[model samples]
Target: MLVPKRNWLQQAGFLTGLYGQYLKVYLKTLVEYRADTLIALVAGIVAQGSTLLFLTVIFQKIPKLADWSFYELVFLFGLAATGKSINQAFFNAPFSLTGYIRRGQMDIMMIRPVGVLLQAIGSSQELNGVGQLVTGIAIMGFAGAHLDLQWTAGTLLYVVIALLSSAVIQFAVLLTISVLTFWVQEVRSVIYPVNWLYDFTRYPLEIFHPLLRGLLTYVIPYALGSFFPAAFLLRPESYGWAMWGVPAAAVITMSLAYCLWTFGIRRYSSVAG
Candidate 1:
């Protein structure tokens, strides 16, 4: 029974089909709220756009902040926004777990063949993140052209890894906070700090006081989501060590978040309606 029954392509093909069906259902619901989607998309665009504008205003007065030029800072902002948008698109929909817990809908997930976490995430998709995705790509491309990135194979590969690690780190933070719901029986309070953190990530981590820097880097490690990766991209030799730490930090923090989630699940008692 322990046979290598399917090759990697077969497994990937099956998963792709599953997600395709998932997206199909999501689109059916999405069309019913056409206006809401438009508003969300516009809000995402304005939000990221305003962040870039902030950088523009700052650079107009000062030559650079922490040795990062306007374009480089925008690249960091783009990294954070892209990673966040991708996470919103694929997972961590707002208020999903709260509804599940309070309504005892976890009972429904209990009998499903898929994992509860997967089912919860699969039930919601954020197409609004498209605005952020578009904005991020545009900024990154503009910054890349100005920065004159070498685009060597090794540098390109590192870029891919850094971006993926950034996404992983961001999602891990959100999930870790969301999983606190299993204890408190609510999510809003837990989710607030993470929401606040995005603003900090849109800028360089060094501008803050040392305590805040430590918090972002070590305690929470939001730095991995944008700053360090961008730092490595802009100044390779100086930030090489920091770049390598992103994936390692992602794995360690995500593993801890998963363990917390499983522990919370064990302790969970659903709220009665």
Candidate 2:
């Protein structure tokens, strides 16, 4: 009797290769409409820019929001925005699973050997998010420099983990809701409110009522996207505990999304007429 080969590393490599192939095709479409990418990038930058301007004006009138100063708030905004832009650039496209299900267009993918979720995302390139990326990094850097942060090696490591965790939280929440379309067949019902929810992270979570704060942190887990980590960095003694929750929130929400997706796939039946 011989043990079966368990090539998990090979499987991981195969998945990576699949993602690379999908991204290659997705990006090629950008050349067909180069101006569109610029337009997209500009649109994101303008949206984020205008919000920052509004916040700036508000802060000029009042010195602080809750325990956070203006620059600290900006740091949170930048972190959240950057994470969102990265998601928009690379991962959020997969939420279109709802659209494919409704259109009966997912049949092709069902027959394919690659992961459906990965293929869904790799199918499209949203390069306009590049604007958000640039704006986010610049703002984060400006805020980080001005804000008196503890710049330890451990702190820097936490920042990097928090950034990634934020992206995962955003995508996991969106995909979790969007995955419901497999059964509901209503895209607007699921995706439209994600826009509203996304705004919850653009400022310090402390400003919200305790109930709402809990909703954002545990139910939606939006604070993990930026606010929690920013707070941890700004006042480590106070919010350092929240930093660990950032990655934990990501893992929990994403795990829920995975379970939801598995259920959705099992219940998935062709809507083709």
Candidate 3:
């Protein structure tokens, strides 16, 4: 019997449907553990709220930080927090890649017909991100009310695109680090220190030294996912490049991450082997 091959669109639809099924099961599990989910959600909010409180205290001493008003900083922090929440919600399973490799879980995923990356992503959902998502939206709304900005349809669309692209960039960077587990077997030592760099993006890039600015803009590029998007919205004349650059960076970094992921999979050897 000959089987017809599905086109890209059909393949994509299939993957999307499969992921939705994973989400449904995940939601069911969360519903069954309401108390634990609530605790996790509260913990996420408290952790993120503490950062906002710290910023509030700092702003009390000064009207502005690096020429950005407190509301402007809130917008930037909200943007970054939203992007991080999206990443944690949908793409955080790769954080356990080392454990998967050690426990021979990769073998099971490899034998499945689905893409390994998609399978890994669908294996778990970080429900705690729901709290961060809630906080980010609330913070953004609070800042938006205070900031003088035009809210045209184009601006709204651009904001959506920027936030989605920011999440893509974060996912790509984290996935790239996770892929390194194929070689190192334990990449957390590198992942944690690099992850801490995200904190720097919460503040205005102008406040940093040129070297650190360049590092964030080019080397790590977390600023593109956080600062640049908010900057573009807050000051289009000064940050016009971000309108396109953020999406471009997302595509470039994701391509590189997927290539690394593919390379890792090819070279992967099961623990039993």
Candidate 4:
């Protein structure tokens, strides 16, 4: 008996439906642990709030840092926060790959019919990210109003595209790191340094030395996800390349990450063996 192959649209719809089922399970778990979810949400808000407080203190002492005003810095932070939150909310389960591998869970996932990466992504959701998502939007609105940003239709569309690309970039970086667990088995220390690099995106890249600027722009490229997009919006004449660079970087990075993930999975061995 021959089974007909599904087209791209049908495949996409099937994947979407599968992911929706996973989300339902996650939601039920959240409902069962409402107190824990609430605590996590508050903790997330306070964690991000402390960073905002630090920025407020800095701006009070100086009119601008690296020629970026306080509101401009806030805009950059908000963009990065939103991107990180989206990644955490949807694609954060890879962080637990080490545990899955250690417990022989990866073996089970491999036997499943769905894509391994898709299963990893849909296995969990970080509800705390909802707090950061709300805070990021509020901060962006506040800073944009203060900066007197002209929110034309084109500007709005660009912002939406920029944020989604930014999220893809972050997810690519983290997923690439998590995929390393197939060989190394432990990556918490490595993950922390990469996360610390994200803090640099909250400020203007111009404040750093040329080497550091190059590191962010070409090496890690986290700044491209958050700082560049915000900078282009704030001063389009100054950072014109950012309009195209950010999306291009997202596509390139994600393609490379997915390739790495595929290679890792192919070589992965079962722990029981």
Q: Compute the lDDT of residue 49 as modeled in candidate 1.
A: 81
Q: Which ten residues in a row have the lowest lDDT in candidate 3?
A: 1-10
Candidate 4 per-residue lDDT, tens place, 148-200, comes to: 78999989998988888887888888888988887885898888688678878
Give me the overall lDDT of model 3: 0.87
lDDT per model, in order? 0.76, 0.79, 0.87, 0.85
What would the per-residue lDDT of candidate 1 be over residues 1-273, giving only the tens digit for each residue? 343466889866866676788888877766888887777778888997887777888889999998778888888888778777776776654447777877788877866654577677677677787667777777777788888689789877777787777777777787788887776656787687776776687678778899988888887787887788888888888888866687898888889977887887777654653
Model 4 gets an lDDT of: 0.85
Residue pairs in clash, model 3: none
lDDT of 3 by residue, 116-193 (tens): 889888985788877788788788888998999888999889888888888788778878998888888588988878
TM-score of 4: 0.93
TM-score of each: 0.86, 0.90, 0.95, 0.93
lDDT score of residue 262 within candidate 1: 83
* Candidate 2 accuracy as TM-score: 0.90
Residue 20, model 4: Cα distance from true site in angstroms: 2.4
Candidate 2 local lDDT, 226-258, one digit each (tens): 777877787878877777788888898889888
Question: Residue 110 in candidate 4 has what lDDT?
Answer: 88
Give the TM-score comparing model 3 with the true structure, all chains together.
0.95
Indicate the worst ten consecutive residues by lDDT in candidate 4. 1-10
> Looking at candidate 2, what is the lDDT of residue 143?
89
Better model by lDDT, 2 or 4?
4
